[model samples]
Target: MQWKTDGPRSIPQAFPYQGSKRALVGQILSLFPTEQVPLLVEPFAGSAAISVAARMYGRAQDIQISDVNAPLMDLWRMIIDSPDDLLDSYTKMWHEQQQGENSLVEAKAYFMLKRREFNDTKDPAILLYLLARCVKAAVRYGKNGDFNQSADNRRMGARPANMQERIHGASRLMQGAKVTSGSYEDPLVNAPREAIVYMDPPYQGTTDVPDHRYLTGLRRDVFSETLQRAVDNQVSFIVSYDVVREDNKYGEPLADDLGLLHRNVVVGVSSQATLVGRKEMSIESLYISPALVQRLGGQDKIDDLIDVEPKTQDALF
Candidate 1:
């Protein structure tokens, strides 16, 4: 299925992501009932995929995208504000890395090296484009905030065609969005009461690499306090988290304690051939405040608002 948007036609349908909700943006938007465009805040806005989709589908007006990772936040700002300069720098770096003129280990390594270097520099847009090229699509990092993933030699496809055009198109679409670097809880302290907050944090699970610090030790307590604060302030919120089996020690209890309406949507976790070796599935559990649900009119209308279009298996994997 073709996921259409009211943005640039040159933008590629496939983005660099392992568990991207690019297909589920429409569905997530449907959960909201207010016609007024509330400020949409994505605290852990990885790749800003959901925020981009929310804007594209006309779900929200202004978006506040934030992440704890400085490099990732720089990338979002660049993608939205300075597409031309970013694309030019990315093209030069990519060409140099491709010709073996750079000491970069591979395409993925080259992508991370550029991001690391860009983080310390003043130019943030260039860092974003370089990240899109590197990072194994998932953008994993070690505890020291180091990009330490091996290149996926098998899926090293050519640089996306019309890169500049797509960047410009997306930038135009995201004109009003703001990107920032900080802890998720710090920025939302004074958010508008009517605003909608979407939280997609690191899953509650063990990591293969002992130091693969995706969330910096965000446990159930932190998530609980965040939700309680939003609830007290009458802020409508939606949280997406993985579903662990009943036997597992950690699972739906997190959502249960939040005291909000909950719903589960199944999503494919494997888009790469290498990932197919592990039969993994991702479940998105959306939690909303009870008052917001009633105020939005009803649950049925909210359900109809969100939609998901499954992509062709061949196209994604």
Candidate 2:
């Protein structure tokens, strides 16, 4: 699949997910094999910033994206397979809200209608609108597994023209990719030895709360075992899991028994803390499989790529 060069130079992001790795694309991609690989796989696939970046830079000849959330994965499917249809549906809904006498009231009402429709039908367009307009673009779910986030009345979702460009751009880059909605384990277990599987499962802090951040919460033990299986299979992988903000660590670090190389990547200050009148640096944990670490040289080489001094999980914790 040959994509045209008319797309934006920057990585094209099609979703407004809160924990997206859009900011860390450069650092993450730098850690990938310098030579293009046969495939790049993302199991969590939220926003798929890494996949998008990989495609943009020709880091992989093929890409595979999977997520537990069926509707969310369906949106990615639409974006990759039929971007124009997705764009048209989203644009129509985006413009229809303004047709009413009072735009705000109408927008709220339109949001409610779409939310109901989304819950009932799992339409990708409605989910896209809800995510774009929802508060902080954070996905929240009711106990019954319904889309429960409210609309941000101050503004409409992404402008149609911009959305179209992004949709088309992402579609072009992610062309010929295999996308699926199911267990993250599927992609991990099935990934070829030469493929690099990137896992960004829901952070332990976010998923363990009463208000679930993801549609499903991944158990730590299950995840550990999954990584173990991947390691036993000699699959190269990287994980963006856990973080520490201003000396306050969120979630437990992965078990040390996995023998994965651990490094802390400074991801800049915390916007959430800054909003509440505090300045805090946000540092994220990057866990690399031994095979990947060996392939990328060694601990020192990986450290230099991310521009962070050598540090272990114990120091960060």
Candidate 3:
């Protein structure tokens, strides 16, 4: 289906993922180069929401998706290259867990078995099932770098029919896209001049810490240096870093001397703050490279475009 800016809020998502950026795709796509670029690269491509949106909107002719998490990338590769096989495996596992009388207990057991298999053999389908049933669809890895998140137990993952549609939709949109498992550096540093590199790295607060959500922890200093290399190489890029809740910024801002322009796209109310009896708006900082800023009609012109809400959705999803 062709996605219009004013269409429904739900984008075609192969699987549920925490911090997927699916909600922000419209606003993010608005900032992409108006002319269709030859290629679009996503190094830290968790869910690859922006790349899917870019393809659907005809903003990119080719795409590259990479991540440090091999199993996650394997799942993405399956979604892109072999949707039917992946869905068949998921469907079988989804039905297998429904056989027992104690539904919840049986389902939890099924999830645990799949999680173990994913950690042991790194099966893409098992990983997909685990993410679908995991708590908050949040990815959590143990010190041994195994997927350790527990099952939600309340609902079965996406229905077979729904999963089928999402998998097919995402696969169709990303046909022929390159999928890889590697560090963010390869794509970021080697992006062609005609390519637009979109990065959503682990936030400063989450990185360089023990027992964090990500399997691989990134050092801020090292990440900054890599970004500098990209800038020095004249790569056109955009970064989705930390968020600002109310007037409080969550993480340290990127270095100012990197030759980039910064803007905050208001992402609506903070769920965390609202639960504590307070209403605070969350605004995400978007760092645009000098090349991209000029490509979009310089800083002043881009400011006017960024200030307006995306026509696709009335509020954050």
Candidate 4:
């Protein structure tokens, strides 16, 4: 069907992220205001996929991305400010990967070595390589706030040519974006009047998963409070999550006071879930601000706003 980012360098969505909205970039973007969108703010910018795509597709000319994971933010800043240097270091290390006999063991050992390098220097290249080599691109960390994910043998990380192109492609989209390292609340606190804020924070349903393991039980209340302020200021927002509780699944809905608009957004089967059993379907409710809703024609429900079909369930797989 010619979806964007289906292959290497196929779309402006350049970063290879774990749960990227790259494929759903179109669907997510369908909700953008037809009027001028001044800024695109993504607080939990895991891979900055949505932010970059929004800029590339003209949803917004400016972007601001932040994450509590400082090292992750460091990678984006490096890509934005010095793509060539970051790519050079990455290419050098990527070429150093082991080949032939016992390659898996050798490569895993080398990955840990580079991870240590990333920890010591906070080098963007090392982090990029680690993310590509780590299991399912998931970044797990210990209670000590250190990366704890082991290498995955099942995957062959992207080759250097593609990876280099990715860095450059992302750099192009980042030309006018602000990259920061701090809490998601910081971005919300400073959200502009005409900005569109999308929060894809750690999902409450997957606390056991590696990506959410470290961040769970930390920011629920604080996030709710900060969101309230954004609401008070009439800032636009689209939060991905819903209040749900099932057999073994549980999800949290947005704070009631904000009274944001919402619609179901079906996501693909989780890669992490696939490892444990058969693929499991997941769905999120995108809670949009009243201001954004009115901008989209003040409708109670828009066809593009809610996608419940299985067709969209694998957008990121």
Candidate 5:
């Protein structure tokens, strides 16, 4: 299948992420036979970038995005259903915060402060936009879900301009797509048999930068059970995870114990303190039934997915 890139040149500037599958969506789509164009589902939709891009490329007919995080889901809904109101509210909050105004205080403040501290300014819209932009694109939180992280050197571009285009494009393309908030297992348990599940769970392991909260202990067993059910039901699914040592299985061995298809897709080099200078490669394990793999061809199709080039640096305040 032929593939074409769409959207603005500074698209990533608007939608920043870590280990985003946006670049590889094309390769994955290329592997997908034309007949399998629609019914794409992202069970763990962090930012929904992959599915959104898939729709933009005319690859999928419908996308079902689900996540357990309420705030993230709320943000997604606001962007798609009420972008104007959301942007206006965020903009007002941004300007007020910039002027040192403290009248606007609420759950939204968590997002605003995180963005400001991370971006080094008080532009609420830009901050909220950044919070929306990052991979999982989330603000780091503690056990209580309180935002508590300082921004690093990674600077993004103007928030409003890029956000407008992304929101507009995503909102239009996602007309048939549905976004929901719930456990990953819930959607899969209730989804149609023909659905394809793309799982990008939080990296399971220790991190040097202990700020971001990916997936916690809420439903670890449930996640594993869901994968098992997918395999039993002959559903097609792909799961991505961080690299871990054989000695340290972290309770559940990813490929060995989990019974995931043992195809390792090389990702970026790891910079984790424990694995510093260690090649830093990640893998995508396929765990659906063999019949499903045969129906979808094999790893050759998935191996073709590639990443797009990162956007140029710019001032984002």
Candidate 6:
């Protein structure tokens, strides 16, 4: 199951993730170093969606993937180490909840139990199962870092075939990829010479306050130095963060003093837009280091990657 660009749109198959980059992987991959990058790293491996694209497409040789969330990494490690066993266990659990006269009740009960039992069990498969069955495809946590998100409002989960494909695909992506549990800094500091590092950290917030769920908030000012460190050490890094919209909503732009090249990827209004009669808005900026930009084969490729859509400027006014 190779990661493919020639798919339905440019979206490759990915696990159910709330902020899944399935829609954006195509564009991101197109911007990776056009030559052989020794190592490809995703520090914030939420679903490891981008690396899956790299693996599926044969983009790089050595891969290093990690995340701060230990349990989430555990699930991915399980799939990579024992794809068949994890798949079997997940399938059984999925079907079990569909049985009995009170199937919906049974399903809800099952989800809650797994949600509660996750920390204790540290069962990779259970966590993966819940990610599919959980609300909004989200993974939220309490201050103590417990699985605090609720179960889905609906009765049915994803079809058996769908889950199986994603399980297999993720397993394939994880093969030989250095999956680890720790802060993003380790991978950045220890990155292979000329490795291409793609980072999607807990977002910088609009209120300048961290979303309690994504508590591993980064300080833009400090983080800019982090990106610089990666570059100074000869590592190519790309970071995804909030960019001001045409209406100055969604989130504030990365601090202007960083001296990094940013490309705005326009994402239209989501269904959950808050304003009563507001126009659609939300754009993410990718701050790429100069060395990485140079490695991406001059301004032509960079221009394509930054391929900004025709946005109405009036919204900003």
**Residue lDDT tens for model 6, 1-317:** 11137642333343577666655565577677754566899998887777877777777777888888787788778778887787787888899887768888889988887777886777888887788788877677666667777889584577768777767767766589888898888798568766888887776552233224453556666766777677677777778775555455455655566556777765445434544566655556777777777887765568766545445666422
List of clashing residue pairs for candidate 6: 2-56, 3-56
Residue 310 lDDT in model 4? 43
Candidate 2 lDDT for residue 25: 69
Worst lDDT 10-window in candidate 3: 1-10
Query: What's the TM for model 1?
Result: 0.77
Give a tens-digit lDDT track for model 5, residues 220-257. Answer: 56667767776776666656554333343233445445
The predicted structure with the larger lDDT, 5 or 6, is: 6
lDDT of each: 0.61, 0.82, 0.82, 0.70, 0.54, 0.70
- Cα lDDT, model 2, residue 200: 84
Off by more than 4 A, model 3:
1-4, 208-210, 271-278, 308-317
**Clash tally, candidates in order:** 5, 0, 0, 1, 9, 2
Least well predicted 10-residue stretch by lDDT in candidate 1: 308-317
Residues 1-317 of candidate 3 have per-residue lDDT tens digits of 11235431456788888877775665677677664789999999988988888888788999999999998899998998889999999999999988899988999998998888889999989988988899988888877898888899999898888899999999999999999999999799889977899999987767455445687888878888998998888889999988765435678888998877887776556656787897665567889988888787888777766654233332433
**All candidates: CA RMSD in angstroms?**
5.5, 4.2, 3.9, 4.3, 8.1, 3.9
Q: How well does candidate 6 score on lDDT at residue 188?
A: 85
Give per-residue CA lDDT, model 2, range 237-291, as digits (tens). Answer: 9998887654555778899999999877766566677888877666778899988
**Pairs of residues at least 3 apart in sequence or in different chains that clash in candidate 1:** 26-307, 27-306, 27-307, 30-305, 30-306
Q: Give one digit per residue, the lDDT tens place, for model 1 in 26-126.
A: 45666655643578888888766777766666678899989887766776677777766677766776575666644445655665566567545736554
User: In model 6, which range of ten residues has the least summed lDDT?
Assistant: 206-215
Total clashes for model 3: 0
TM-score, model 4 to reference? 0.84
